[model samples]
Target: MSQVFDYIVVGGGSGGCVIAGRLSEDPNLTVCALEAGGRGDGTLVNTPTGAVAMMPTRINNWAFDTAPQAGLGGRTGYQPRGKTLGGSSAINAMVYIRGHRSDYDGWAALGNEGWAWDDVLPYFRLSEHNERFDDAWHGRDGPLWVSDLRTGNPFHARYREAALQAGLPLTDDFNGAQQEGIGIYQVTQKHGERWSAARAYLLPHLGRRDNLTVETHAQVLRIVFDGTRAVGVEVKQHGEVRTLRVRREVVLAAGALQTPQLLMLSGIGPARELERLGIHARLDLPGVGRNLQDHPDFIFGYRARSTDTMGVSLRGGLRMLLELARFRRERRGMLTSNFAEGGGFLKTRPELDAPDIQLHFVVALVDDHARRFHLGHGLSCHVCLLRPRSRGSVTLRSANPLDAPRIDPAFFADARDLEDMVAGFKLTRRLMQAPALARWITRDMFTAHVNTDDQIRDVLRQRTDTVYHPVGTCRMGHDALAVVDPQLRVRGVQGLRIVDASVMPTLIGGNTNAPTIMIAEKAVDLIRGVSRVAAQPHNDAQAEPHVEPHANYAPQARTVEARHAIA
Candidate 1:
């Protein structure tokens, strides 16, 4: 029997949860959301400490690895995405950052209409129920809970003080009027418990509404297309295959890595690639799996002089035992910590339009997304290039949907990106060495010996990986290769839309979780025909050149040659 719904949301992730939950608000509509993973409300999914364990393993993570990158000496980089109802949000750092306002404006400038900061600001406010902030910039009543650090950990204050002592300015809010500065990061939590999109949006409506259906362990194979229109999806659940029909639209809320792979499997990708794989092309959308962008990140590790950091030791193990009791009683303790307690956006060059890099101060010594372990207590800091000229792709490993996509981030593909990272390394190293944090550091572990630009470049290439903010694969724009338009409608495919990070035309300055939820919130309005701004086909010549959405992309023209100016 074919299940039927007015709307079928594929991939019950951050975006799918919002899409299904909001559409269910209209009693007249029937919605079905299918997740590839288990229910994301388990103890491991809700506990912040569990994220540390999950990321290093496949507990609730896809734990995908990239194809060998020439930039990293032909080494494969780890890519850990959440494999649960909340998607990556369930196993993320829980940092509630919406990115810089200029990032959205940059999208609008590139011919994506109605996506400017001013237009998308309302959606950001609409999705957040902030616990501490209440102003023109924040919302007080919403599903997602955004709050200040509720734990008693004292490391965030020390990190911020170090950033300030290192000559960086302080900004209380990274999402406010000013986007430049260092401060304690706000998290997606409620009473110290992890508040993922599933908890905030979908879980509430699971049993409350018969109109909405959320199926777990249901892997979407491909879209069932009648000609060029997507009418349903063929899903495999419990070792059974079934076709679920959609009355109106089929929205792909899968993240950047999976969405394009699904589209390609459905015969809606580059015609040549599809033909070579023995699959008939339905739409020949050349940009389907192209334009992959992720933050190329490098972490600086150090041996801690104090016991404030999270590490393996007799004292730390004892503290953890006591924290388990404290957390069970009040949900507030060291167990509530979201390892990355402090972070900020900073500019490497004074001439750049916005911050070219971002900082994440961790309470533990993180190596390869915590895949690698170390002894004793230590701390680490991450410095990632915010905007890179490099662009990679997501292509099908095989015609089989069960197979993982071949992810090629092509980190530092553009030479300038490496240069900028070299510059960023110097700037970040100085901040870590500031006197405010010097007292806490016993010895530098990774980059202490790195001094020369060439040495920095060599070390970065050796250790650089992703900060897990991959976007722009199924890009939204008004170009020949665009997969979706500004309204998020798939090009050349009727009754199909992509409402996820895959549609991001460019990379945002900070964490992608908050912005992803906002994208889904705005997508709901667009789908209901209640969009505030009407979409238009833009071909403005005054705008920047249309950045290619493919494997071999031209470097951004704005990339400034790194001079030893600031250092």
Candidate 2:
């Protein structure tokens, strides 16, 4: 006899943790959360700087490599998703951004009702407990904690000065009245430690709640369907396959890459792909693993003259040791740095409706998602296209459940995205040349003497890759290709819901973590049949943004290059 639960949340990731935690709040509803990785309670997860060690290695990470992309000149991109309980939140840079307000409104425009900026703002507020702000825009009491960086580094001011010198506006808050400016990013941290989604929602409720059962190393092979209804899951835990029955729903929070893979593995994806793999098609949902979207990023690395920037050196090593001591004592120092210490939102051209590009100013030189390390102290600034017309997919490598899914983020498939990236690069390069930053830099690590649009395009194709935001595989919409409805229920199946980034119809305008948590927070209400109707925007929330005009960017932003296809 298999154990039963009212809800069986697959993948104890960012979304799964919230789903399980929220459902289990009712003593009557028994919820079980299954994670394929360990319990994510290690020092590596709690410490903010430990991500430097975790992201570059396979410790609690999936570390999957994509199929060779012709976009990056035939180079395979590295995707380091968190396999542990917190999911990517445990391994990510901990930058908490809710994208742009227009992002959610755009989703509503695409037939996803109740997802407009006004509709989702309540959920965003409901999930946050801000350390600084307590206004209409931010929540004062919530499960998740959002706080300013504890590292009082002098570079924060310098980064601000650099942006100002480059003629960008300033905003004290991104999740406030304005989001279109440069500012220090507020992180999902509390008291200098990383406050991942699981940490905020699940960890505290562990032994306190008898209705909640958190299972680690439990990998679900497939959803056990009773005809078209998902009634249970067949999971492999500790080398023993077990059937965990679900009384009400089988929710998948297995992230963008895996949730769709699980659907396909359960014979609910494209009929042609299932037939080729010899799996009987239970539900012919063609959009199960389609519509993959990500932020294709280009980095500008500069060797810094100052030793204060985080890097490997005798002087920096001595400083890090001191910072470690300070962290242990007061939880405030360079050890609390999230690497991407500074962030900005900008439009390549003044005519765009919203910011076309985003920036992540890393305190250290991060190469290949921090896989390859460089010597000496340096800083890196990442510029990525916020909304790429390019699309990709996540499909089955084989019929085997244990096999990794194929991820193909066909970057630059649309010629327009590359051109926008070129304009963004030039704008960022101008900031790098500003006196505030230029005085600290020795030389450029990449893109030196590369001026022309064609040269920029070639280098972009050679060097551009993801900034770790992947979404929209199991797209949520009313359209036929949409795997899930706006309510997040699987289209052709019953008792199955996807509550992760995969359900996003389109990638948001900024970091995805905060928005993903809001998705799960809203999903809980949907699951409980108590979902609120999206309210109108707050009185103060609807102000027009103050955008500085760039008369020169609009004309030269056009692409003169031909489209390139990946083989």
User: What's the TM for model 2?
Assistant: 0.94
Give the alpha-carbon lDDT of every model.
Answer: 0.87, 0.88
lDDT of 1 by residue, 1-567 (tens): 339999999987899999999999999999999999999999988888889889979987899999999998899998999899999999999998888878998999999988888788888888889886776567778999987776667776677667656777666677766677777788999988999999998998888997989999999999998887888999999999999999899999989999999999999999999989988888889998899999999999998966678999999999889888989999988888899888878888778778888999888898878878899989899999999999999998899999999999999999999999988898888889888888889889998788888899899999999999999999999888899999999999799999999999999998999999999999999899886433332332333322213221112312322232456
Any idea what lDDT model 1 has? 0.87
For model 2, the superposed segments whose C-alpha errors exceed 4 Å read: 532-536, 540-567
TM-score of 1: 0.94
Q: Each candidate's root-mean-square deviation in Å?
A: 7.4, 5.7
**Residue pairs that clash (backbone atoms under 3 angstroms), model 2:** none
| Best candidate, lDDT | 2
Q: State the lDDT of candidate 2 residue by residue for 1-567, as single tens digits.
A: 239999999998889988998899899999999999998888989999999998978999998888888777898987889999989999999998998888998999999988999899999988999887777788868889998898887788898777766777766677877578777888999999999888899999999999999999999999999988899999999899989999999999999999999999999999999999999999888998899999999999888978779888999999988999999999999889999988888877776777878999988887778878888999999999999999999999999999999999999888888888888888888877889999999979888879888999998998899899999999999878999999999997899999999999999999999999999999999989886545756665465433333221222212222111100
